[model samples]
Target: MAGGVLGVGIGIVAAAAAAAAGVGAERLVRARQTAIDLGVEDDFVDIPDHEAAVISDAVPLHVEIDDPSPGSPTRQPTVVLSHGYTQHHGVWHYQRKALRDAGFRVVLWDHRGHGQSEIGDPASYTIEQLGRDLHEVIGQIVPKGPLILIGHSMGGMAIMALAEQFPEVVSERVVGAGFICTSSGALSTVDFGLGKQIGAAVHRLGPGTVSRLSTRQKLVDTALRAGRDVEDFLVHRYSFGSDVPMAVVRYTADMIFQTPMSVISAFMPTLLAHERTDGLAAFDGIETLVMHGQQDRIVPRKHADDMVARMPHSEYIVVEASGHMLPLEHPEIVNTEVVALAERSCRAVDSGKRRARGVPRNVTDLRAGGRSRRTTKRAAAK
Candidate 1:
């Protein structure tokens, strides 16, 4: 359901998906299928790719600048990309390059314990602490600018924390916000697209299970490393919904696996307790866009709806057949929407007329873009 299960559950299940491959292809497929029936991850486990996908380049990500929201823009508006749990700024690979090409100064930072950032005190792993950390990142790196804050998964929660803790950040200087594959709160209640019984069971028990596993951190890491192929497959399966390049799948795996089981467990409890719907109010008059994958078993689209309901005027998008990692699975759509958000934010600031503070008078309008989806009001509430 959340990273707690994604990290530890994958460890427990990856062994099944890949370890059994030596037994026989049929058995391997069955084990993979069992993981799928649980509905805990993305298109995660249907079977392995026999074709042997290949990638030509192995480019390293260059992450610069860090942290949370707004202030008046002294120059070109800055776009801050916040990634989810078990991920680093690398998660925004496609979007970062696209945004930079689009001419906006983009900033990215790992949440404490993620990517280049050092893991702080275990006690500081809560979303509240992440929010404060984001504030610090903004102060130190971005300095002065009208910010367009974009968050995915836990990163989205951190943005909500920003809204809650520093209202002025959202109202005074933040021109736009983009919430991707994130929930407003009540994470424990949803079944993660698994049936009610299974979903409830996983959410209830997953965190504690992962925490216990973290105590044997080395063993867990060993299991995780042993399941390297499985990790790549699962990352593709759970993180993305559509067909992504095998290289992209492995890249995602690298980013997530680089994170230790300890850090994953450190943040689990807070994620389970995350409830920041009240923070949605901070972006009241600012330009806001909320996106999620319709097929995302993790942090389902309904959660995006919960956010839109609160910020009636915020734009809502759902990429069809997509999973949790929207930016990676459907880069064009995410890039287009992000560019539009930045443009809107800049215009809003320049015009000095913040959009009206209320729900859009019209219900969400779904535009047919063929391969790319333009979700409006959860595709008119689907």
Candidate 2:
């Protein structure tokens, strides 16, 4: 039994090694293609977040805004994009551009410890703190606009935290919201699609094992650069539901690798213990979109369904072949739905009945990747 535990412990670190491998994927691909091809472009306008409160806090979030194209309608509400765990603001690369092009000002920022944002008190890494940070972003950046909040994974949790922490903001200020590839809670119960018993064992052993490995930063860093191929495979398996380019996988992994293992582990407990189902209450009358991949191994489809069940009016989408990285995997679909969501939201969508999955006329059949409802297969949530 002791040996089994130790093996799992070691396995977690070994798996992390690929994720941490630094110069491997970045260099391997940088030589062959431009940085943009590797998905490393940071061309958006960046206005550093320097609010006194932001500066004085445990740490200041790095925030930026993309103004909607000039001459676009001024009535469009500002859209804020929040990324998932380990991902920096770059995760919303495609979405931000899409929103801005669609004539909506877009605000984006890295979470407290991820990306260029300075790492804060590890103790301050709670989801509630993140929610507070988001509130700060809204208070300072888009203080008086009809707002649309879009979150992915942990970012989604932060939004829930925001809703729970500041119900008034959600009820009064937020006109529309998009919850993508995320959960309201019960994250520990997730099995990464490994099934019941085996998943139970992983949940029991994975956190402590990974946390222990996370402490040996230098060792993990060294191991990270050693296994480029392994990292590629592991990231691919965990992130996307369909085959994507190696550049995309490595690019995604590189972003994940940016968060020091220490910070990653620090945030683990909050994620595991997170429960914000109550937060969904704030969106009861607002236009909300809940989307996830049918093939998502991390949060799974059940989580999305559960969220939709709570907010029956929310438009829930379960992309047929996508996975955890729905925004990256199917940018067009995400952008389309989000833009449509914003437009519908601007007009104040009626939070009506729960649209059940299938049942024709409502299903968006885009398995082949087109927006036409006439497409072959669909993934609309009920």
Candidate 3:
């Protein structure tokens, strides 16, 4: 009788798995159909003169540049966007379009081991290395410019690491920054929506287990393929808040699914060990925005609050009905904040110039002068 019961239980489990996979397949089909109906092909026109910034660790970071509008000012501040773990520069599609339309030059790049970039030494997957990669990308691409830096999730952590290691760059070039859905430290303590005991055990055992598992790439791939539907469901659950469109959810799931498991495993240890609350001090004088979702399960709202407490001057916002993927889930709010910060930074720069020249700080006069200069430059370019 016990043997019969066990067999029945196994059968039930198989049936549930089959049902989930069927649902997931349907969602995927609908998402692709929607994309086709929308004629989204032109949205991905290849960026002209795409460059690669090769880091010291032999990782080639794929870089793309979107120059400001033809009539925009020559000295317009450049906005550099960094994506999070298991994501590439393509994830910044909406933010990029908004920034570009608002007359800001934009820079986007894939982190080493993710996206189209070549995966270099797995041992070099620490946040510090990622910071160095950022530095190199800046030095090689936007060598000299007033800048606004934006990062999400692990990308936010990368910016903090950059501020920690290269404070001079932050002070000298960066005028503004945005940290969205990210934490400075204590990630291990967060529940991550996984069971408390299970989360703890994963945190403790994840690194070593991943290292061993990575050696068997075929086995890992096969296991992942078998569990694709379950993985998609978990990603959708943890990554978004209430009422996200199914197409958007599927799009995000596709990005996550495309990332290699080895890359994910290699970065687990660095993410768990990340601690850089002190780095918040580096952006004290710079205009900064710290945003998070109220219902964020991965990083939590407290992390955003903690960052605000440290950098009191930084603007803090909590999206009411968003989750870990605030950039995609709440693009409009994020884009507005970023554009405002960019304008503020530009005004601050103008204010500093006036102060240095010992001229009276007249906001009206500065605005007129900037407009006149831009007009003159635009005519000359034509």
Candidate 4:
């Protein structure tokens, strides 16, 4: 009788603890959502009748958009943008604005485990699965036309995985590819501080366990305290080129913090073991550009150099004063290069020509390549 009473008491305590933890986590998530100031979601002009689809039954993977123009022969080439780990589609804000302004149809979506998207089983958040999502997105969007894939970090690796997994898709639909501040292989071999180690350990533990561990309020609270300082340092070092608006910086930090711990853990393994040099084959006859920051401490500059060496037909540009977030840090430079690539391709397209240009022109070319040697001599003399 005494033992039975003690057992009952323990059960009651456990139940109460579980309920309290649940309430706390719920409150945290809600607070996080409210604190996040991602500016206006309206940056995307919605396309009428656009709908999101649940890709997998086991996972509530979703794809949403404001595809203003659809089924109109896709007049402009489509660029599908993917964000890095612990980040949402908003990371591409600058690139999206620039691309849309340049008359390109941009498609940006959150990965299955991140952002406003529903988080399903932790197992569903692997890099392979992310690549699969890209494949499906491509199938739905550019069924019969060209696509330009732009990815940063994990997003970039996901693109390479897509190329490897769906060779046919690349051969058929993809026209140009951009890898910004990303690695082409074995991220664990690189030195990225806590990112690589924490990522590898999380991947080994499995997503479900990591998710559960992340729910521990004590751990979450402690990490949150330190994570903020780390977040600020990273944002300053990587995200901004120079001085960014304080509001923007704060908003970006909120998005980064609000990202659930499990989501980060699940995708960590994918980044570490990521090797997609083989994916370069898909860019055989396609235009490819690899950009990296020479000062990048995250993805490391050598990874980009290796990619340039591997992808024979690709152009490699090393931005001198940029970090891992080259797309944000050097938006003008990135924008200019992307625009030129698109223009050159459009000219070939309008002329109904399909000759492949193995080498891409650089900033110097844009400034002087078109001019005659005599004009160059005259300018130099002047």
Q: What tens digits encode model 2's per-residue C-alpha lDDT throughout 207-259?
A: 68768877787887787788665555556666777665556766677877767
* lDDT of candidate 1 over 69-113, digit per residue (tens): 234233367888889988877777777656666667777777777
Instruction: Give lDDT tens digits, candidate 3, residues 1-382.
Output: 0000010111122224435446455654443342234332224334633565656567778888887757765446788899888777876778877777778888898888877788878799889998999988888888997888999888888899999999999988888888988889987687554457545544555555655655766885686578655444455556766455555655666666566657766777788788999878898788787777777777778887787778777766666656778777667777877777777778878776311111111111012322321111111000
Ordering by TM-score: 2, 1, 3, 4
Q: By TM-score, how accurate is candidate 2?
A: 0.81
Residue 206 of model 2: what lDDT?
71
Q: What's the lDDT for all of these models? A: 0.68, 0.71, 0.67, 0.58
RMSD of 4: 12.5
Instruction: List per-candidate RMSD values in Å.
Output: 9.3, 6.8, 11.9, 12.5
Kindly report which residue stretches of model 2 are placed more than 4 angstroms away from their true locations once superposed: 1-53, 349-382
Clashes of 1: 3
Judged by whole-model lDDT over C-alpha atoms, candidate 1 comes out at: 0.68
Residue 43 Cα positional deviation in candidate 4, in Å, after optimal superposition: 9.0
The estimated TM-scores of all candidates read 0.79, 0.81, 0.78, 0.71
Could you tell me which residue pairs clash in candidate 1? Answer: 42-238, 44-237, 312-359
**Best model per lDDT:** 2
